[model samples]
Target: MKIATPNDRLKQIMKERNLRQVDVVKMSEYYQRELGVKLTKSNISQYVKGTSNPDNKKIQLLAKTLKVSEGWLSGYDVKKELVVSKSELSNHFDKIFQSDKIKLDLDFANQKYENQEHKLTFLALLENFDKLEEDKRKNLLHYSDVLLESTYQKDEYNIVATMFDNSMEPTYSEGDRLMVSFGFDFKFGEDYLIEYKEDILIRRLFFENYKILLVPLNDKHPTTTIILPLKDHFKVIGKIIGKIKTSP
Candidate 1:
């Protein structure tokens, strides 16, 4: 007969997701870096113990990190799911591609193909590309290279690299072929292949206070922090735009 409090909802969701206070601490660190909201293990413990409540900005950060709705996290009688708007999705895509040097010309493709069937065929080819035999895959790759060479001049952005480590696992596997865009423009919250201290590594970038945080997706790996004004210590090889899995 008692109304649930924000602490109660937070405890419920954390229990449901098997997230401990320490896990929240680590996860909230990521949001802290991205959203510039400060959170600590002590804060999480206080919230869990119902001794303190998070402010609006902290509530928003928690909701995003926990993949729940802010209203639900705030103990409102709303659905727990987070509903993302189309504009939000559009803005996310814009943030990714707006700074890229290579532009995908979907309009040009439509104009050249002209027929819906042709578009469908191209889609089918893309869908079945990985399923093709080794010889067929080579042939397709050759054909693609020929088309691209004829269409556009080769640039440094044409670099493609294969993942040889599990440091970025789950999101990118060991054998995945990463399509890289060569640049030094480090966008926060996006993954990039970087060269630092003579080692080439892939990490998600973030800027906090005046430090650059290079975070690995696999938490087992350590996050590297560099001081501002990067200097000669850091070099960005490229940003990872897309990837191809070697296996199904």
Candidate 2:
């Protein structure tokens, strides 16, 4: 199969949206007006004509104006919206906008896609872990390069999360990191990162007659354990695989 270049994909998306090159020019102007960045028509034309490539910021602007996801234009089958930070944009700008002839090596791109398709993509939280409920923790701080071999689905096998507090104690303190295996099924008396009362917590879980018990390891705390029904409010995010301390 003939793979499309980024510019080719851009052209295709524009056509799908019934947009002309002039429309893209207008959108570039709009992006400049809104972000205080120079989105030149020349640059946009270069991107469309395969003469140059836009950086992440420009690509984001174009994607927004074109009403498409970045993944779609890059030919990744994705549904979620992607957010690129200004710092990341600057880095991409330095790399891509340097040369006039932007070559999209389809072979390398295809190889990278194939390599990462089965790779486990573990994500860290963008916001405070305590503030985010299990379902609300949608924003990813970053994607780890580490990959693990597993037959389970991609989401199920990906694991590990940074510690938010000293809740787990001795096992994992505040600022420590926990490696987890989402693919590993839970067992009684096992440590896991779980969601209870909308909070992501690390605790030992025990199963009993349609109920789950969350027990903390810290003996200083009076609350020995928390018991809740095995229902919506309770869920196991991942089983603890390993732990890393931030400092001595």
lDDT of 2: 0.53
Top candidate on lDDT is 1
Per-residue alpha-carbon lDDT of candidate 1 for residues 162-248, written as tens digits (9 for 90 to 100): 455567878885534466776447669998977787566788989999998999889988999998787757877788877632211
RMSD of each: 17.9, 20.8
TM-score of 1: 0.37
Task: Give the poorly placed runs of model 1, Cα more than 4 Å off.
Answer: 90-248
Query: What clash pairs does model 1 have?
Result: none
lDDT of 2 by residue, 85-187 (tens): 5465344323322210111122234455555453332111112333556433221211221111121123222444545444567776543445666578658
Each candidate's clash count: 0, 0
State the displacement of the C-alpha of residue 84, model 1, in Å, after optimal TM-score superposition. Answer: 0.3
Question: Candidate 1, 192: how far from true, in Å?
Answer: 24
